[model samples]
Structure formats: C-alpha cells, structure tokens
Target: MRGGKALKHYVVDAYSTIEQNRLYYLRSHQENLWSELYYGLTDDFNRVDVTGDNVGHVVLPSSYTGSPRYMKQLYLDAMVVVHHHGSPDLFITFTCNS
Candidate 1:
C-alpha cells in the first residue's frame, strides 16, 4: 500500500494529471492494494487509447527481468516524453525483457 502511494505520487508528479496518475497506479499495484481502485478489481481494465485520453492501468508480465536501475531509467525516460507530449498517457505493454 505504501508502495502504491509512493508510486502514485511519482506518477502524479510526472504526469500532473489525476487520470494519468490513477492509470499508472492501476498498472503498478494490485486491485486490493489501491484505495480508490478504478475500473474494477481482479479483472483487466479496458483502457482508452484515443489521443488525449488518459492511459489507463497496465500490468507487466511475470517474466520481465530488468535491473531496478534500468527500469527506473526507462520510466524516467517515458516520463520525460509524456511531459513533453503533455499527455502522460500510454497503454501498458509488457516488454519481453523489461
């Protein structure tokens, strides 16, 4: 739960949008873990993909294996792009190797 709040804050700071922040939270944490769980619990949430729509939650596959440093860097890069694009929205696609 603490992890989820911390992650949510990071996402909110990165995206500066409530919807995007919630999306990131949905993707990163379990349904039971989040306080304001959106969409539903224990089922995949269908995300909106149109331009300017908030990118909803995502779940990475269990097979991803990347160093925490690398994952953080990747997330940071994505944040930069989102900040630049002003959307901070993305579909969660699990990379084969993180």
Candidate 2:
C-alpha cells in the first residue's frame, strides 16, 4: 500500500480521480476528444439527459450513495424486492430524544 491506500483501494481512488478529471474536461468544453467517443466504444449511457443541441453534461461519480440517483435506485430495487417477497412485515425507526 502506498500513502496508506491498499492496492485495490489505490486502483479505485486512481480511477475515481481520473474519472473526475474526465468529467471536468468534458463539461469544460463545447466538444472534446472524449465527446467524440460518447456513443462509440468508450461508452456508457449519458450521465444526464440533455434537452438541447450541443449541450454539456457532468458525469455523476461512480457512486452517488445518498444523491437523487442513489435514492431512485434504492426505490426501484425496493419495489422489485417487494414485488417478489411482498412488502416488509415491519418498518421501524430509531430516534434519540436528545
């Protein structure tokens, strides 16, 4: 491990930094080398839906654990689980009065 990062964590962190840079570059320009590959081999779905021509997008990070996208994924997954197993039998919340 270098700089306290394990080998696997290093790769993940490195990739995340690279991705953050890539997204920043894409959004910084009207068009870029990256954009040329938007629907080509170096591709995935758009991070955001564009409504106008020649628009830009900011790629969401690889994970958006508490963001809208995360919530949507959670909701969809919950619906699927409930559909197969029925709704959960109990729902509970723990609170601290302080």
Candidate 3:
C-alpha cells in the first residue's frame, strides 16, 4: 500500500489433486505475520480442497505485486514449500491482464 500505485490484479490457475492443491495454499499462506482475522479464516477453512482446474483472482497492493524477479522467487519458494507438503507435480499459472 505504500507504493501509491493502483492495486494489481492477477488470475491464478492451478492444476493438481485436491489434497495437493489444498496443501499448496496452506503452505503458501502459512506466514505468521498475517492479521488475526486472516489466521482465523485460514484456520476455519483449512480443510477445503480445489479439484480440477482451480482458477481465482486476487488483488494485491502494487508494492508487493510487481517485478518478474520477485514473482519468480515467490513461485520458486511456493514450489519448494508445497513440494515438501505433498505432491511434487503441482502446476500453477499466473496471469495479469491489467
């Protein structure tokens, strides 16, 4: 939010087994610095699964959403974490059409 730029939008498409996908999201959002409300929401829905081609959109503050290097690092980190959680064959695609 400190960037003073407009929010950036992205579409994420993930293909994997339900359990694998669930684990991917769980690990991706496992950081402890999130607000209490966010923790509660994640805890409440920890068992949810995404079957087949799961697609969703997210709006991120500009300061945290740009730069290819940063995005690539995030993807790499996510893959590493998710790999440790379960399947090593998870596929994720991110698209920004804005």
Candidate 4:
C-alpha cells in the first residue's frame, strides 16, 4: 500500500544518488557504490513487510556505524524514508548510544 510505495520511492532516490555520484562514492580500487546501496535497500524491502500501520525498521550493519561518509549517506536515506512514511516510531541501529 502506501508504505510500500514510499519505500519504493526511497529506494529509487537512493539509486539516483548513487548513480549521480558515481566517482565520489566509489570505494577503494574503483568499486561501484551503487551495488551496495541497491542490494541493501532491495534486501530490506524483500525481508520486511512494510505497511501503513506497522513501522518499517532499517537496521544498518555495524560496518556503517562509525564512518562519517557512510553516516551522511545514511542520513540522506533516512530523510527519504521519513519524507514518504512520516516519522517512524523508533530508529534503533543507526544512532550512537554511547
């Protein structure tokens, strides 16, 4: 429903960002950044059943936690989710709890 549409939009936007920033976001040895973003979003979309009533939870792996660049990217991803789905009830793994 609405939530699914929202998630889809978010994924599309993430893909767009990766596509637009190919050189800047590339990893060491010239790896494409788009694959990671695409796989992550698609995997989560497939794993979770997002609905209007239930909240969609996106858990970033521990690897993405400390890096500033990754965090910035995550922030952008989150904005897309919020823009479409409204403020979620809770955000667990993304924040620093230290």
Q: Which candidate has the highest TM-score of all?
A: 2
Which residue runs does candidate 4 get wrong by more than 4 Å?
1-65, 89-98
Worst 10 residues of 4 by lDDT: 23-32
List TM-scores for all candidates, in order.
0.25, 0.37, 0.24, 0.25
**Can you tell me which runs of candidate 1 are displaced by over 4 Å?**
1-65, 88-98
lDDT by residue for model 2 (1-98), tens: 35565787888989899877865654575334334423322333454454685344454322434545567668988999999999789999999988
Pick the winner on lDDT between candidates 1 and 2: 2
lDDT of each: 0.56, 0.60, 0.50, 0.61
Rank all candidate structures by their TM-score, best first, as comma-separated numbers: 2, 4, 1, 3
Q: After superposition, how far is residue 69 of candidate 2 from its true place, in Å?
A: 2.6
After aligning candidate 2 to the native by TM-score, how far in Å is the CA of 47 from where it should be?
17
Model 2: pairs clashing at backbone N, Cα or C within 3 Å: none
Better by TM-score, candidate 4 or 2: 2
The clash count of every prediction, one per candidate, is 1, 0, 0, 0
TM-score of 4: 0.25
Judged by whole-model lDDT over C-alpha atoms, candidate 2 comes out at 0.60
lDDT of 1 by residue, 1-98 (tens): 57788898887777667656664654667555554323343443334334544445344332233534358668988999888889846668666865
Clashing pairs in 3: none
For residue 24, model 4's alpha carbon misses the true position, in angstroms, by: 18
Model 3 C-alpha lDDT per residue in residues 61-98, reported as the tens digit of each score: 21243544358668888999888897767678999999
TM-score between model 3 and native? 0.24
